[model samples]
Target: MAEEEVKLHGAWGSPFSKRVEFALKLKGIHYHYIEEEVLTKNKSPELLKYNPVHKKIPVLLHKGRPIAESQVILEYIDETWKGYPILPQEPYERATARFWARFIDEKCWPSVWSSFSEGKKEEAIENLKLLEKELEGKKFFGGEKIGFVDIVANFIAYWVPLIEEATGKQLLGEEFPALCRWKDEYVSSAVIKEHLPSRDKLVAHFRARFPSN
Candidate 1:
């Protein structure tokens, strides 16, 4: 594949943006990463022009063409790069992978975030259990390899623990031993470790945002 200009507009603290960033790095794609001020609502003009509809971060600019949404960007990266495929080859498996990825984005993510922010402990535990079931008996959602679902569920490997620490809540524990082990392995893996933000930084981000959650 020939190299073309690739850029990503994202913010450090956003799991959505981290999804795109991790996808790019996992695919060995080099890109210019632009940090956007999402917290202050001072989003970059380039971000606005690229993603005018949503005006959100994690926009992938390839050869100057913009692709919005982290999930879509992950697909684009996997499709564009032939090597190190993120999705499964079989149609059924690929579909199932996409289903779980969407599940994490649409269902699990909201539940966890709302639970943390609004102090809905039961809701958080219930949703996390659903994810634990999904991950049980498999090395990853893609089965033994890091793939699309793993990338989509990247927040679980890092942010969840950080949030628990910051909020003094126990969303994951002995009850979900497999999920906990997965987090330990995922974050410790060299490739993921290289891209993941520092745990201290993540903890600070959460503490500042939710001091008494």
Candidate 2:
């Protein structure tokens, strides 16, 4: 079937899914998007069949072969497709980009979540500061163009602010001037503006999780 040629199982609200979408769009690759009910316990059978281990959103099926994990899928897309490259050409630059993406997923995200939920800001603040330093004087983490690191960091640009608004918890503020500026610029772009989850839907999602919100 045409849908199986290049299909993606993802959720609208997931930044992970958006990462794959951005790479495909930028590369001018055509694909079918399958929206899965990721919030519920009963995940779709397709999702389970594909990424049976994690059973998560953002499972990419290209040429009928399944690829799980957002970071792994991103590298696969970059290597498989030509033009509108997601990663850098040079080895050192490419490695640097991967380093930062890993940092975002492993260190930055956990620290930021801790700050949001536990009222512990030091680690998260430091993580943001590190990313801010890396992004200094650049339009994006991937320099002037939106590349791998920027795709990995869509959460900082879109989701965090909505969650903050929903929970009435102020983690990001004037202190993160560069990050704040980056957030504004990133979200203002037509591509990002188009694909990001609606603010209303996200706020409602967060409020549901944090009942007091």
Candidate 3:
């Protein structure tokens, strides 16, 4: 297979960007990583050009063709690389995976953030319960291996704990034992650990972002 020039434009603190990085690494694909400073108005011209619509971080350029949106990028990577399948082969299972991924990205993320910032912890816990049921007996969302839903829910494994610490509240508890167990496994997995930001760094970042008590 001929190697294509691949590049990813993203920021360090973005879970969405990390999902793409994790996908690429899982597929054993090498690519250049370009860090974009969205806060400082330092988004590169290439990033702006590639993702004019969103003008957001996490733009994957494959042979100079840009793929915007982390979920879309994950699908693209799985399709392009035949090895290390990210989505299941069965149609029903594939649809289920995509559905859960969308649920996490759309509904769960907002609820989780609202709980952290607005003090609506109950709402976040409800959302987490749904995931816990989905993960009932599975080692991962993708059964044995980390898959689409797991990648999309990466925020739960890393960022949510920091949010809990910063808010001085425990949003997740013994009620959701399965989800808690999954989080530990997901964060400590060798591939995921390599891509995750250090716990200290993440704690500091959250503290800086949400300093008020």
Candidate 4:
């Protein structure tokens, strides 16, 4: 491959992987897409070499260098590409954006991911409401546009709902109308919708993974 080439190693059903795609598309960068069979634990040698520690997908190979971790790769994409920006411009704003993204990955998403367990739903809703409150007076965590935090929270907008359906859990509901509205707005956008995994495929993936649900 040429030194200037860009390649993305990812799985189709992964929200982490797709967030990187969202950034690349927004930046109008053309990249080769390499699918890794992550679900079956059949990681490729290339993916292993690129992300040896994680042994996972969503590794971005740009200019002959490997960048792992979706969040890290996102910042790299924004900095390396010229058109669209995933992170904010101002120093304080950029820090705040990173903070919220970290909160989603560390706090909110974890709470919801385990909410199916007994007595965990309340904790999950509490964390979700924290995010809902953050969305106040803004269309997205990125304000009027989609930014780093919004991309980080893509799992909540798409995957979490499917998890609720597959697990028969009530994490998202009428209690948070603002979040519901934001979810629809985010997922319905032409840029995001164009690349989102089909609902049928996601539902089937969820069902197959959690058959007991």
Q: Rate the local accuracy (lDDT) of all candidates.
A: 0.86, 0.87, 0.89, 0.87
Error of 4 at 209 (Å): 2.0
Give lDDT tens digits, candidate 1, residues 67-162: 999889988998998878898999999999899888888888888888789977676678778878988998877787789988888898889989
Query: Deviation in angstroms for 86 in model 4?
Result: 1.0
lDDT of 2 by residue, 70-173 (tens): 99999999999898888999999999999999999999989887877777889998899899889888888877788999999989989899889888988778
Residue pairs with backbone overlap in model 4: none
List, residue by residue over 1-213, the lDDT tens digit for candidate 3: 334588999988789999999999899999989999986888888888999999998999898899999999999999998889999999999999999999998889999888877777777788899999999998899898998899999999888888778667787789988888899999888999988877787788787777784
Cα distance off (Å), candidate 4, residue 40: 0.9
Best-performing candidate as measured by TM-score: 3
Could you report the Cα RMSD, in angstroms, for every candidate shown? 1.5, 1.6, 1.4, 1.8
Which candidate model has the greater lDDT, 1 or 3? 3
Residue 98 of model 2 has an lDDT of 94
TM per candidate comes to 0.95, 0.95, 0.96, 0.94
